[model samples]
Target: MRKLVYLVATTIDGFVSDAADSDPTGTVFDPVGAHAAPLMAEYPEMIPTHIRPMLGLTDTPPKHFDTVLEGRGSYEIGLAGGVTNAYRHLRHLVFSTTMTGVDDPAIELVNTDPAARIRELKAEDGLDIWLCGGGTLAGVLRDEIDELHLKVYPVVLGKGVPLFGIPTQDSRPGLDHFTLRSATPYDSGVSLMIYDRTR
Candidate 1:
């Protein structure tokens, strides 16, 4: 069975993106500084197909994921930039109810239960599934996440989209636990933390 890895970049205050829902790595800060080389070298698959050539990773095989998952908001960011499918190199899946007529055969849309569908995907033979998120979907599939690979930036957004967009006060499912596996800090004040879900 494959694992579901939530690989995302977040601020020290635990916000994945700002309130405007713009790409944090683009508008808020650039990720091409000192941390770029090691990050891109370690996770080449995370680079978009169009960017691979520029980064000289055009022929590099994906080191981690063979499939990429994202919420409607995350998908729409690329769509808004005239890109219907951003991660065209991988099996792209978008979870959205209102989005219709995607037309891109390479991109799959899941309007139903996220966790259930994820369970099915985990059972199939493949590399790990990358949950390249936008908070809400992370909350929905929180229970199914097997690993968390967080790139913690030094900045602090006073308020924005949180790491987990779930409501905390409600009598929802209990919090899942994870064990920190590794933490690598870069000169750019960015740290990469890897945590494995505690079963």
Candidate 2:
């Protein structure tokens, strides 16, 4: 069975994007820093297909994930840039109920329950699934996530999207479902932290 890995970049304050929810790359966060080399070398699959040639990773095989998942917002970010399918090299699934007319055969739109679909995907034989997210989708599939590979930057976005998209003041108490597996600090003040689900 393959694992569902929520691989994302976040700020020290635990925000994935700023208040406007814009693309963090090269704007709020620098992707070409010291951490770039190691990250690209290890998880080349995370790089969008269109960006591989410039980064000299055209032939580099994916090390961690074979499939990629995203929410409507995350998918639209690329669509807005005229990129219908960003991760063309991977099996891409976009969860959206209101989105329609996506003619890209390479991308599949999932309108059903996220957790149920993830459970079905986990039972298939393949590399781990990469949950390239927006917070709302993360909240829906929180319990189904098997691992979290976070690129923690040093910046602090005073307010923005939460890591899980769950309200901080929600009545439900937090659960310790994951344990820190490794933490790799880079000279650029960025850290690659990996956590594995223990429950």
Candidate 3:
């Protein structure tokens, strides 16, 4: 089975966005511009095809996942600007309770148990599935996650949406066991940490 990887960026305070409750779509983490150099260089596949050349990474191929998953709020960040498909290179799947359909043909809208669908995706033959964003969805599918690919930045968001929407560690005590597989630190104080679920 393919791995369900929660590949996301987070601040030192463990918040994914700045004031997620108030402005979830706002770009809270400011260091992404400077941090993008090492990140895009190391993980070229993560670069979207639309702005690849603009970032001087046109030939970069997706190195990790062949499919990407996102929550409604995560996908809506681009939807407000008429961009339904942000990552056009990979297979995009968005989870939403209210969104029945979307304008983008490349993106699929699903309103059901995300964990069940994730399990089914793992059974298929392809690269691992990338849990793109949203702490709420991450909290819901916490158990189903096999690995975490975190881009840890130096900034701190005192109050915002957490890495996981809810407290996974507090809710399931002694269940959230993970070991750091590797940690690559960059000059910009951004670290690429890969942790595997070891339970």
Per-candidate count of clashing residue pairs (backbone under 3 Å): 0, 0, 0
Model 2, TM vs. native: 0.95
Segments of candidate 3 deviating more than 4 angstroms: 21-27, 31-34, 167-174
Segments of candidate 2 deviating more than 4 angstroms: 166-173
Inter-residue clash pairs, candidate 3: none
lDDT of 1 by residue, 115-137 (tens): 99999999999899999998878
- Give the Å error, residue 20, model 3: 3.9
What TM-scores do the predictions have? 0.95, 0.95, 0.88
* Candidate 2 structure quality by residue, lDDT tens digits, 76-184: 8897899989998999999988887475898888998888899999999999999989887887788888999999999988898777875756524668488999999
Candidate 3 lDDT score relative to the true structure? 0.80
Clashes of 1: 0
